[model samples]
Target: MNKIFFDNWESILRTLVITVLAYIALIAMLHTSGKRTLSKMNAFDFVITIALGSAFATVTLNKDVALADGALVFLLLIGLQYSITWLSVRYKPVKKLITSRPSLLLYKGEVLNDVLKKQRITIEEIYVAARKKGIGSLADIDAMILETAGEITVIANLTDDDSQTLQNVAKK
Candidate 1:
């Protein structure tokens, strides 16, 4: 009976350690990537994330690295992310260096030809976004800006749903 009880206890402890280590590893990996990295996962990001998930899960499930060792590495990564975030926030130059500014897509309903060429955006995309709001012509737009996030913002001449949204931002 004593042997059986000890075996059960050992199994439970091992399971608990694996669970904790798995979570810590995943969280640490995500935290280290920064907010910008998660904005959009391209093909490269999808492949890397899958590969890493497999390796980390195996390391924890197989008990290759001791629970403490995995946890330590995870915590160290988290700490490094925290340090970088703090430094980036405190330093203006660093903040500007990392954060991208919004791109001016159009001014007074006229597309900035130079910006369109620089951003590699085709005229077709501009027409599609305008058409989404029942706008057949770009002349109806006052200003349109594209955020660094690749999101399009259309400032229309009238208060449609799209214009209402932009007006809400101003009202606030």
Candidate 2:
């Protein structure tokens, strides 16, 4: 019980040194891995971000995990992320497997109820998104999209041009 509150000066010093080195290694690895390593673009990216944090915490608090081991773990994760992202960019199947397609929640002033239910989104949430976009009326909303990043994008019904922006969006 006493050890829980105060381990010793050596342990404290070890933790301090390890923490600083681990932090520097993490930052350097992240910088080397590029922006995609820390992106919240999709669920896979989110998972990687969470895993990195967990590894960092383990390195910081767990004496069993050496600084070198933590650095290696960071490298492994970042390298995997980089490789997967690279492959995903070149291969359609890989991209499809790792990422989700955006869903159209509203179209031409009509609410896609089935999509809303399937996506576990409520009409009230859509309304709030529209309001955030400064939309005064539902009739003014041309489309509402549930993006892969879990963001609600409200499009105004001001244009008549047949834009290809919704070409890849899932209508159902």
Best by TM-score: 2
Best by lDDT: 2
What is the TM-score of each predicted model, taking all chains together?
Answer: 0.53, 0.95
**What's the CA error at residue 40 for candidate 1, in Å?**
7.1
Model 1 ranges with Cα > 4 A deviation: 1-78, 157-172
Model 1: how far is 4 from its true place, Å?
A: 36
- The alpha-carbon deviation from the true structure for residue 22 of candidate 2, after best TM-score superposition, in angstroms, is 0.7
lDDT of 1 by residue, 62-117 (tens): 64576666556555544554465467679977656554556667766788888887
